[model samples]
Target: MDFGLPKERTSLKIPPALGEEVQEGRVALTPQGVRELVARGHRVYVERGAGERAGFPDAAYEEAGASLVSREEAFGRGEVVLKVARPTLHELALLRPGATLMGFLHLAVAETGLLEAMAEKGLSAIGYELMGEGPRRPILKAMSEIAGRMAPQIAGRLLEAPLGPGMLLSGLPGIPPADVVVLGAGTLGRAAARAFLGAGASVYLLDKELSALEEASREAPGAITALITQSRLERYVAFADVLVGAVAVPGERAPVLLSRELLARMRRGSVLLDFAIDQGGVAETSRPGIYQELGVTHFCLPNVPALVPRTASHALTATLLPFLLQVEDDPLKVPALRQGAYLLLGQKGGHLE
Candidate 1:
């Protein structure tokens, strides 16, 4: 099908992977997206049933110009591997030497042993979360929007009967709706605020920047926006029915904003949901917990967007497809693809240039 690459060009052996540990949705590349690469003179392999749980059947990939293969073959054949989550230790061993791996590396939280292994094996790795800075992160923003929108829904579920306080997020006439507090005015915080507001809850959004706080306040009429200070945040915590920690620093660990004492002071039936847990979290106790503790329920899954794999996969493909095509022409020479390569491999080895 040749999408204009040179006749003598080297094809990119790309394979899309299925997540092994994440019980929910995790396939990032869709069949339609894979077909785009196939049409561009790149060979794409889809692991058998990789996209099934994400609503893509094997036949769909076959029809979309992808070669369906076993997981071992998918890993063995590809010089460049695409995935949504970080590859496990076992999966890491399957990679061909010097293979390029791209996904949400979450290096701050990644195991030292794993990083060392990749170094020793001369593997090139790129992190989706750090691909671009600020709003420039098209892929990260798309997934963050999904997570933000789901924040209110997750909080609401926690407040439902048997699960939490038995209170509704949206109250009846003459009753007050839940108070939803979101930390950070970034893509994630804004999305969370909008979702909670749409559900008829009063939203309070806080950010370190005055410009951001003002922007959020102006954009969301009737919702409160405030500068983030320890005192101000602590006071708000006492009044919040749902506290969502979505604050993050690109390529760095998230700052801890809530202390145990402040958390204990929160309303007994309140919900503490930390979306930044994957980045070391924004609270002292912000790890995933099944049972509520400290008089509050905590929801701290690192891959929240993976809960809706189909939607996330489509969003991912939209952002990643262009780059995949660029790589086919000349992976090492293309400026953007080169940037990605350096980010993964560093200057130590594995095609840093």
Candidate 2:
């Protein structure tokens, strides 16, 4: 697709993700995915070692019809940029005016200054989270499913630490399994419930939507699904050995479901893992990485899937390739672009809407 000027193919760029040194994971496109895009007639420039951390060697990309370029060249040559995370202000500044930037723009937690920078640059920004509404948001669903599957594994490890409950999440014969409470019934929450169940934990899945709760129950036959209410939430929180907050709103900040008072009522050394931290968290006490407050250990990693970048990159690449192929047209007007993204961006003072 032209992406901008008619009859002109879009020049795409991929830069190496910056999460390696920082210990946060984010390389989201695989070399195989890149090959598919190139096969569709678009030129793709990948930075040297862009997918290295994600287990994709430079030679793989080279063989995939991608040109290996320096960091500066990757940024300078492309009319359209695709990345796993939002670019730094310095990276954004390198783009030519009106360039197209696509990635997961965590608008709610993002600084206003960055939005202003995007506006000043007149860049057309498309967020992965807002690519489509409901089931049409394939990117969000794919990533969230991976994150959900990882949640239980992460919580299981934390439970064995000094500050954890010091018990096996999946108990043995004649021993009671750990009690897991998953808040929200969306893709992430359902995936978490299934994983916990598979590990032999007794899972309580709660959500405001009855339909969502029903779906969770059907998906995980043994899981207990209940309509979330203040009393039910308080009761469950007090009894839970592990609490997972996976609530999300497509284009807005996730609502804080666990208040400080609610947190204080939980048992000491219990674990609270908030998968929703990327959008400002669903628990009042949740923060990025690990922390402790009210005697409860909170594990809130914004990019949980980054912990398994190779797998994540493959899934993300699958969802992104179709969209990339359509870039020859005006992507901003593509019906698949979630309208709520425009709402959120406009609300954040961006000019894209």
Candidate 3:
């Protein structure tokens, strides 16, 4: 598992916030977030080009008192690797076998091959998505926010093409507002609803659960329409100009909320933004695409955060680095579990037993 954005161990803290693409290796932090770590005695390592894509430069890491190294050595030396994407087989192949890995481990429906490999490696995988003990699954929640909030922007753009609605989302004069229908009243769904409503569109929120719909109703107040669905969801699908799919089931494939046959019923240019696309889309037509789909005109965006690396990185980093500092302090917390073989150790040897 890796949200996989990593820094080699170092002992300095950045004094300010770093912007996206600061110059590879240069990550600005709240000087205090770093200073506090130093007070506890920790070292940070930076890979030569890790932050380059995010605009952080190598010099910035040096200035922050971070030693630089090749990606090979950085991961080689680090026990807890922070990353954006889950570690690939090649990445796992490089690990010392019994390593503790953390990030968004979407294991409920993880790729079978990856699961087999992880089990084979004896990995004690702690899913950021699943780590929430009782009521607060924080990491997965953040990822959902990333996908949900961005769904509207993607939908609006796709709907504006000539073959599509061909109109600016907000009208100029006599034209009416864009109509957006949000399915599911969960966190991601609500975020999409709030964003669309704020953007001057007519928003309709539909959910089978009255509790969810009622809670959303309270937030929207008079601004939005809360439709409590007592029957099948068929009628709701027929009326949507833009449909945002935000439903979820932890550790399982996303359930189909809308069928292709049903999707064909929406306005020809109507857009379906399935934020659930990552775990098998809610729509038959939606599936993960190549990175270039950053401009994915039609269908869902599986990796929405990569498109807004600047915001996504900062948000992801904010949550990750603190835990990293703690691990750095108790280096054994990571390597010990790795060495002990009961924790998130990848499935390497029969040692998992």
Alpha-carbon TM-score of each model against the true structure: 0.89, 0.89, 0.77
Q: Model 1 misses residue 351 by how many Å?
A: 17
Q: Kindly list the per-residue Cα lDDT of model 1 for residues 201-287, writing each as its tens digit.
A: 999999899988777776677778889998999899999999999899866788999988899999887898899987888888777
Q: How high a TM-score does candidate 3 get?
A: 0.77
Residue-by-residue lDDT tens digits, candidate 2, 41-76: 777788777777767887998898888887766766
Q: What is residue 265's positional error in candidate 3, in angstroms?
A: 1.4
**Across residues 1-353, which tens digit of lDDT does each residue of candidate 3 receive?**
21122542222221122222222222323223334444555555556766665556667656665557766655555554544455677766655455555555555545658767766766555555544435555556776777767766766766665435585666557888777778778878877787787777778887767898888887765335555453435666666677777777655578887666766666666667777876787776776541112122345545566555556556655654455455543333553223322234444322224
> Could you tell me which 10 consecutive residues in candidate 3 have the lowest summed lDDT?
10-19
Model 1 root mean square deviation, Cα atoms: 6.8
Which residue ranges in model 3 land beyond 4 Å of their true spot?
1-39, 222-232, 290-297, 325-343, 346-353
- For every candidate, C-alpha RMSD to the true structure in Å: 6.8, 5.8, 7.6
- What local distance difference test score does each model get? 0.75, 0.75, 0.57
Candidate 1 clash figure, as a count: 1
lDDT of 3 at 154: 69
